[model samples]
Target: MSSDLWSFALNVYARPGVEDACLRLQTAGANVCLLLCGLWLEQRAVTCDEQRVSLLRTLTEPWDAEVVQPLRTLRMQWKTRAVDDAVLKGMREQIKSHELEAERALLSRLEGVAQAWARNAAGSTTWLEELAGAAASPNRDALQVLRVAATGT
Candidate 1:
């Protein structure tokens, strides 16, 4: 598996069931980028703590709200109408690609911050769960799928 967040996210997300799981979690209000970041940090043995979790949230929430969400909303809004209009469909595809690029940028930014955190051999990380917060219970199975796929266990 790749070590960088973007590459690791691509590799893990390509695993069977991971895409569905991530979508499910995303629908449940979890930030998919943060979830991927959590998985990356956990694999590196970075300790999970309230401060660290808060920092990740602080970095992610605004970017997601201001950038990714708007692109997603526009893409989704075009779904039905785009089907019947060729031009709309082309624009929708472009928006979808832009959304992906925005997410990749988020992951890169996350990696930059996370790389400074030292990994501890004895540390236990629950980044996925913590980041998922309230959504963790409802999307437990989906979250587990991510964990399994991320760790290849």
Candidate 2:
């Protein structure tokens, strides 16, 4: 992985099976940006705790709901219609780009906050599991695939 969260996210997300796994988790209501942040933190050996989790969520929820979600919803709403309408297609593509930028901004924010945290003697592995807590039960295999790719274990 890379030292910076955004670079690490780009690398890990491009790994085989990771995109699909992330999509599954996303559909299951997991925040992919938060999950990516978890991977970055775990890679850095940051200790996982309720306070940190709470802090990250506090920072993320509003941004995700206010910024990313609206753009994603607009894009998704146009998915099929955009296939037949050229103008809608262009607008939808723009929405997709905006959604991506929003996510990137969120990841940057997450990195900024998490950078102050300390790393442990042993690399902590609870990040993804804890971050994905709600989605874990229903998306076990998908989560495992993400874990394996992120940790290479």
Candidate 3:
């Protein structure tokens, strides 16, 4: 796995089925940032426990709510107008870039929090399940698909 959070995110996100599974989880009210963090921790063999989950949520929820989501909303809202206006399209792209940077920052924060928990133990699907537990109305099957795609189990 890449040492940099952004590079790790890009590689994991590019895996087969990961994007769709993430979208599905996001649609069901999961914070995609937290889910991605869970994947990153799992990749690093960090032991997933309730305390770690709580710490990650405490750190990320506010950032996602305040920064990432609003930028994403604005970018999506401009999609139709951007198609017809080059200037608007450029602005939209800038917003998208900011949103991505926000996500990268969140991932970096998560990595910092998990640094002490890193281990040589084999990764497990438990973190994904625990993280998804708070999702408003998660799709179990979709979560399972993500587990397989992310962990190859």
Candidate number achieving the greatest TM-score relative to the actual structure: 1
Q: Runs in model 3 with CA error above 4 Å?
A: 120-124, 134-138, 151-153
Q: Each candidate: how many clashes?
A: 0, 0, 0
Model 3: how far residue 19 lies from native, Å: 1.3
| Local lDDT at 104 for model 2 | 96
- Model 1 / residue 11 / CA error / Å: 0.5
RMSD of 2: 1.5
Cα deviation of 57, candidate 2, in Å: 0.4
lDDT, residue 1, candidate 2 = 59
Candidate 1: Cα lDDT at 75: 99
Each model's TM-score, in the order given? 0.96, 0.95, 0.87
Candidate 2 local lDDT, 33-132, one digit each (tens): 9999998888788899999999999999999999999999989989999999999999998899999999999999999999989887886888887898
lDDT for model 1: 0.92
Give the CA lDDT, 0 to 100, for residue 110 in model 1. 93
Model 1 bad stretches (over 4 Å): none
Better of 1 and 2 by lDDT: 1
- Residue lDDT tens for model 3, 1-153: 576656777876787877888888897778877877777677777778888889988998899999999999999999999999999999999999999999989988987888777576675557777787756245777666655655542
- Model 2 residue runs over 4 Å out of place are none
What is candidate 3's CA lDDT for residue 72? 96
